[model samples]
Target: MNKLKVAVIGCGAISRLRHIPEYAANPNVEIVAFCDPNIERAKQYAETYKGRAYSDYETMLKQEHPDAVSVCTPNSLHARTAIAVAEAGAHVLVEKPIASTEAEALAMIDAARAKGVYLMVAQNQRMMPEHVRAKELVDSGRLGKVLTFRTSFGYSGPENWSVEGNGTWFYSKDKAIMGVTADLGVHKADLIRWLLNDEVSEVASFVGTIHKGGTDLDDNAICILRMKGGAMGSLAASWTYYGEADNSTVLYCENGVMKVGTHPEDQIILEMRDGTVERYRADDIATNAGQQSSGIIDAFIDSILTQTPPPIPGEEGLRSLKVVLAAFESQTSGKIVRMT
Candidate 1:
C-alpha cells in the first residue's frame, strides 16, 4: 500500500479531535505538517501528532507537497485554502459548509476539477452507521417513498469546544457567515439529501440569534424543505438547546416512519402503519469534539489511494450549502426561496 503524506491546516479543536487522530490511526497515511496562525498551537499539535509545525500553510505545502491535506479552518477560509491545496497538487478534504458562499464553493470545486485533484467535504453524518442503514432501507423499497421528514441538530455553542476554549471565530460574522445555520444545519442538509437521494427544490426559513452572546449572526434557524421528488421536510438548528444536544431525524414514508438518532440506544426504529415495530441498531453519530473514530479519515484515505472520487465530493457539499444559503435568503425575502 502506498502511504499518502497528509498535512492538516488549522490545528483547532476539530483538527485535534477528528482530523489528526483519524489520520494518525490510518496505516495508509503519514502525518506530515500542522499549520495554524497561532504558532504555539501548531507546535503543540505537531509535538503530539509527530508532524512538523508551521504557522503558514503555504510554506508547509511548498516544502512538504503532501499527497493529501485536510482544511479544518473557518468557513470563510475553506474555499481559498482548499483551492490552494488542490492547485498545489494535493487532494483536499475540507470541513463542511464548504465555504461562506456558493460561488466560493463552486470555485473550489472548479479548481480541483481543473487540477485533477480530489476534493471532498467533511460531511461525516453520511458515514453514521444508522444513517447508512436508513439509506439501505430507503433504497430497498421498505420505506415505500418518503413523504415527509424532520431533522434537528443543536448544542450549547462553540465557546467551550474550541481550541481557545472560548472566543472562537464561530461567533464572528465575518468568519462564521451565519452561525448555527452553517455550523449545525449544513450537516442535516447533507444528511437529508443523501437519505432521500434528492435535491431540495425550495426552502423557507425563519432564522434567529436569540440565545448566543457576542454574536450578530443567527444562532437558530428553522427551515422547511420541499424535495425535488415531492417530499416535505423540516430542519432546525440551534445553539440554544440549553440541555444536552438534540441530534435526531425522522422520516415519514408510505409504508412506515423512520426514526434515527432519536433514542439513547435505538439508533434506528421503524414503525409501520399496520402496528408493526422494527428496531435497527448501530453506532451513534460522532460529535465534532468527540474522540470516536469518524470513519471519515479512513474512507478519505481509501479514496486517494485507489484514485477514486471521495464519498462526499465538493459538489455534494455545494448542494448542502445551497440549501442553507437559500434559507438565509428566504429570511430576508420573507418567501420560500427556490433552489436554483
Candidate 2:
C-alpha cells in the first residue's frame, strides 16, 4: 500500500491521545508535520512524532502539501481550521461537534466540497465496538422497533485530563463555544442518530454553569430529543459527575431493553419481555469486529488512495452540529427548537 503523508493541525489533548497514536499505528500513513499556535507544544509533538513543527498552519500546509490533516483545535476553530487545511489541497478529519455554530459548520462543508477533498468529522464513538454491535442489533429487527433512548456522558472538569489544566480552551466559552453539550453531548447525539438511523426533529433543552471556579460555560445540560421516527429521547451531559467516567446509553424497544457502557468490559446487556436476560460481550465472544484502534486513520489513508468518501463525511458532522446548536438555542429561549 502506498502511504499517505499527513499533517496534524492541533497539539491538544484529543490530538495527543487519539490522533497522534492512531496515525503512528497506521503503516499506510506518515506524520509529516505538526502545527499549533503554541510553538512549544508544536515542537514537543513534532519531536514525539518525528515530524516538522510549525506554529502557523497555513505555512505548514503550503510547505508540506500533505494528503490529509487532522483539525483537533478548539471548538470555535474547528470550522475555520478545517476549511483552511481542506482548501490547501488536503483531506481533513476534524474533531467532534464540528463547529461553534450552524453557519460555520455549513461553511466548512461548502469549503470541502469546493476544494474537492474529503472531509470527515472524527466522531470516533461511531467506530466503538459496542456501538457497532448496538447498531447491528437494532438493524437486525432484534430490537423490534426502538421506542426511546436515554444517554449521558460526564466527567469531572478537564483540569486533570488536559496537559495545561482545565484553564485551556475547553472551559472557555469564547474558545470552546459551549461546554458540556458541545464537548460531551455531541458524542451521545451522534450515536443516537447513527444507531437509530434517524435525525432529531425537535429539541427542548436547559443548560447551566452550576460550578464555581470554572470558565464561563455550561457545566451541565439536559435535552429532550424528538426523533424523526416518532421516538422521544432525553440526553444529559455534565462536567460535574464527581466520580469516574460516566459514558452510557440505554435503549428501550418493543422487544427488549439494551444498555451499553464504557465499563464492565464494553458489554451489552439485554432484558427481553420474557424476563430472560442476555449479555453480549464483544471482547469475549465476537472476535471484536471493528476492534481496530486506528480505524479512522486507516480509513482516511484509504480514502486518499482510492478517492472514496470518508467514513464520517463532513455533511454528517454538520448534522450533528445542528443538534448542538438547537440544544443551545432551546436553552436560551426556554422553548422547543425545531431542527428541520
Candidate 3:
C-alpha cells in the first residue's frame, strides 16, 4: 500500500501536540512537509517528523504535492489555507471554527467540491470518548429527549498553552477574531449540536474581555441557544477559570439528567427521576495539561482512503460556525440573533 503523503501547515501548539503526532502514528500516513511562518519552528518539526520544512505553504504545496494537508493556522487563516490546499488537489483537515466567516467557509467548501477532495473540520470534541458515549445514550432513547442543557469549557488562558506564550495570535483580533468564543465556545456549540442532533435556530450571547488586558477580543462568553428540536441550552466559555480547566456538560432530558465530564471516576453519569442512577467510565477528555489522541487524523485519513465523506464535513462545520457567528452578532447588537 502506498502510504498517504501528509503535510501540516502551522507548527503551533495544536500541530505539535495533536496533528503531527497523530499523523506520525498512523501507519498509512507519511509525513512529507511542514509549513509555518516561523521557519525555525517548522524546521524543528520537520526534523523530528522526517519532513521537509518551508516558511510558505504555497511553496510546500507546490514542491511536496501532498495527498492531504492539515491546516493548523490561526482562526483568520483557516479559510484561505484550506481553499489553497483544496485547489492544490489535496484533502484538507482544518482547525475548528472552520473559518472566520460564513462566506469564507462556503468558499472553502466550494473549492473542495470543485477539486473533488475531502474537506474536514477538526472539531475534536465530537470524537471525545465521553461525548461519543453520550451521543449513543441519547440516540438509544435511554435519556429521553434533551429539553434543556448547559455546557462549559474554561481554562486559565491561551497564554499558558499556546506556543507563543503571552504573545500568541489568540490575543489578536486580526488573527483570532474572537477569543474564548471561537477558541473554546465553538467546541461546545459543535458538541451540543452533534449530541442533540439538532440545529441551533436562535442565539443570544454576552461576551467581553474581562481578564486579558491587551486584546479587544472577548475572554469570556455566555450564549443561550435554542435548537430546532425545541431544546434550550446555555454555553459558557472562559479564559479566567484561575484553576484547573472545566469541560463539562449536562442535559436535562424528559426522563432524567445526563452529565458528562463531571466526575473523575465516572466520565458520564445518569440520574433518573425515579431514583435510578448509572455511571460510565470512558477515556479522559484531552486538556492542555494532559494531551490525548483526538482520533481526528485517523478519521480524516480513513475518509480519504475509503472515498467517503469525512466525519465532520465542511457543511457541518459551516452550521457550527454559524452558531458562533450568530452569538457574536447577538452580543454586538444586544438582541437575539436568529440563525438563517
Q: Which candidate is the best by TM-score?
A: 3
Residues 132-167, model 1: lDDT tens digits:
898999999977989999999998888867866567
Give TM per candidate.
0.98, 0.94, 0.99
Regions more than 4 Å wrong, model 3? none
Across 153-199, the per-residue lDDT of candidate 3 in tens digits comes to: 99999999999999999998899987899889999999999999899
Query: Which regions of candidate 2 deviate over 4 angstroms?
Result: 283-294
Spell out the clash pairs found in candidate 3: none
Order of quality (lDDT): 3, 1, 2
Q: Candidate 3, TM-score vs. the true structure?
A: 0.99
lDDT of each: 0.90, 0.84, 0.94
Clashes of each: 0, 1, 0
lDDT of 2 by residue, 197-306 (tens): 99999999988899837577888989999998988999999888887667788999999999887347647888899899878886421111222463567777778788
- Ranked by lDDT, the better of candidates 1 and 3 is 3
Better of 2 and 3 by lDDT: 3
